[model samples]
Target: MKNVFIFTVIGLLFLSCKPEEKRTDYIINGDASGVYNGVRAYLKEKDRTGRERIVDTAVVVNEKFTFTGKVDIPKPSVISINSVNGNLNFMLENSVIDISIDKANISQSQVSGSASQTDFDAYNQGYAKLKKESVDLQNELRNIHRQLSSGSSEQLQSKKDSLTDLFTAIRQKEQDYPLNFTRTNTDSYYSLVIIEREINKKNANIKDYQEAFNNLNSELQSSAAGLYIKANLTTLMVAFEAKSRVDIGKIAPNFEAPTPEGKTVSLNDIKGKVTIIDFWAAWCGPCRRENPNVVNIYNKYHSQGLEIIGVSLDGTRSQKDPKQAWVNAIEQDKLSWTQVSNLSYFLDPVAQLYNIQAIPAVFILDAEGKIAAKNLRGNALEAKVKELLAL
Candidate 1:
């Protein structure tokens, strides 16, 4: 009888200690209720599909909202709100939360909490500080450009030196923050990655600015930001094999390929004049579309020592069309400049030499055959060539 009673007591304790899994719901009351109702929400789940859908909600007033759904309390999920204005994000982690964001910056803004005032204020403070700093830097850069055009040699040098010192100080602060956070084991991996990328970009821009200011030539100096942005993008591209990010003015690696007439051409052959080598395949839509722009630039600047060499990555497909796909596209597109291809597709010698992982790659060489620019496309290409050739 005593043994039976002990077993009964154990059973009751086990039932009482079982984990609780209850269905719960919360209303995410907010300002601009109609704005939330008018917007659609896409819920994203990593490593899963078919979990996304448009959110249907009812708005009560200008600054009130009701989110009705069955949710498990204490679990986290990301809700992405999309509207005509833009996207807003929220993290649902608690049983109840009230979020209020300024309507003006809603597109780029986000907030998260579950009835907590402390976390909201902390997040907003960091966001506001970052935005202010970004704006101030942009304004300073604009003023520097205006002053650059009018400054004498001595004045330019002095200004350049001062800017360099300022950038160095900023970099030092950036490095210290990373190191300090790393020691604390509190820095998130993604946050560290973002910080590293930003620091590298900032340092690169600073270096480019120093070079431009030192050059003194109006044209060369004017293209600094454009060049910096392009070089940084190209460095990130798969074609460049850039282990470390490349800076502007660095010499591109030498490459070779066969001309359309079955003659081998080397970079050395085009050393004396400015040459723009166009790397494209016949199958690429963007490549075909951009051909006309290339032709126009060539026509306008060819006489001014502008040499464009077309390196086709097509062989079989380009030969199949009525005009022969690539050749037809070229002629149809009115590409009358110099053309060459080994018919090797991606394996083309020139493509491999320049690490051509993508179609529509371009390299512009100066009079001395050093790399002047890379990846100048669309309006940027026209603007750059006009400046370089002084058209």
Candidate 2:
């Protein structure tokens, strides 16, 4: 009997030492009240290319549905119902989350049980207020613009100016909110998401994003989003440096390329009292549309010491006879200025020197070949050229 008791004790101790199973899967219990049976709910997420793709699907039976999945980290997901106009957005994590769906208004649906979702909700709530204010300001500005279109009066102009100032202030606030949220909510995983988004914006301040990432707690800094931002910072830093190299007041980088007639021409060769380095492409609709204005500007000011070097980004591997297309566009658009191209599209060496990401990019230079202004269009371009030429 003593031996039996000792063996039983040993077995109990062994059972006690066994490890508990870790829960890695998430289960979503959804209550689509007032919705008819057999409706499908799609779980959606964005792929690396920013395309929305379905991750899972479940059908509502008796106004109830369930979704089961595993995610390495919290992900922003959407639950879209069949025949519904809007989506129910939530942060999907490995937890049992309960969602009470409002079929008539999916965005207003209630969610609980995921800490990440709670934080996401808080962030949205703050952002929505600013968004509403921006919308209101935009509406007012549109109304004033409509009035100005009919006729211009000093009072209407004054009101338009006042509304423009308000709109600008609200927009600045909207841009600052996400960064401010990251600073105050460093512990929240959503902060890392915000930082990643800010890092991707055009002309994003890398210094500010770096500071915000550093302020995050160690755990968040080690998360998937944080690591992505860290890894891409080096590339982004390089791009930022390139931008600084061509900034206004910096000497425009000089390069030579083949002209339409097969002669090599450099910026220094065509340098004048005022020079306009116009980056354009054959297939770009916007560049084509803006060409007339450029031609007009050249005709008006070329005799007044204004020089234009049209750097054509007019070739792609997919294009048949890229040089033919470049020559055709120049003749078709009536671009009379000295035109040059390597016929390599965006891969053209001169485009890379100017850091041209989009077509219709313009760099206006002073007599000394320093970039005086950039990206000016229409009246702004004409005005700057006129001022620089002392016309």
Candidate 3:
């Protein structure tokens, strides 16, 4: 009896001491009282490629809907109902989240239980006010510009300038809001989202944004959004350094590629007193259309010390023979300047060196090989070439 009693006590202690299983799944209990019964509700989120995909679906029964799922991390998601004009946006985490859906005004829907959603809500509440002010200012600016388009008198011009100033001020605020929010809400997952956006901007200051990202809590920094930013930051840094190397007043990066006749030519070998490094591809319609203008500029300026090196990005996988297409395009367009290509499409090393994202890219270099101007086409191209040649 004593031994049995001891075993019973041990069993009870073991049951009491065992750790509870941690919940990894989310249960979204939604109250859609105002929505019609039997309507379908969709839980949607952006995939890695930024495409909105439906993650789960549920049917409203008795004006209520429920969703059960698991997420590795907090994700920005939306809950949409059939016949609803817009979706209810929230941060979806692995927890029991209760949402009171407002059928008429989806934006007014209330969400509870997800901490990340609370941070997102707080950010949006402040952002919405600034957004509204910006919209109002933009409307006023548009009205002024419309009036000016008819005929710009001094008075109208003054009004337009004032409105422009105000519009610019509001825009600066809008741009700064995310950074400010991130600074104060370092623990919020939304901060990582904002940092990702800031990193993706064309002219993003990598240093400042990198500092902001580093300031985030260790857990937030290791999240999906943070990891994405970290990877893209490295890419952006490479492009940024490339851009700096080719900026106006900076020496153009030198490169060599195969000429149409199967001869390799380097930029240093072809550069002249006034050089035009024209990046184009045979398959690019805009580049083809712009060829005539470039040809005209070359013909007029070639004898006067203007030299052009046509770098073709033509070897896409679709083309059977990228080299033949490039050669054919040159002949078809009457491009008489020195032409070169690797027949490797956008993967051309020269194109990568110059940070060429699109075709019809032009970089005009002055006497000493410094970039004088960029992407100047039509009349602007001719004028810059004339200026560089002192004609």
The top-ranked prediction according to TM-score is 3
Instruction: For model 1, name the residue pairs that clash.
Output: 32-63, 318-325
lDDT of 1 by residue, 117-203 (tens): 233344445556555655565566567767777864776667666766665565555544433332332212222222224435533
Residue ranges of candidate 1 with Cα displaced over 4 Å? 1-168, 175-247, 271-273, 315-324
Compared with the true structure, what per-residue lDDT tens digits does model 3 show for residues 6-78?
Answer: 9999999999999988679999999997778889999999765567889899999999999999998888898
Model 2 CA lDDT for position 301: 88
Q: Report every candidate's CA lDDT.
A: 0.57, 0.89, 0.89
Which residue pairs collide, candidate 3? Answer: 315-345
TM-score of each: 0.42, 0.64, 0.70
Which candidate ranks first by lDDT, i.e. highest?
A: 2
Local error of candidate 2 at residue 89 (angstroms): 1.0
Number of the candidate with higher TM-score, 1 or 3: 3
Candidate 3 at 334: error in angstroms? 8.6
By TM-score: ranked, best first: 3, 2, 1
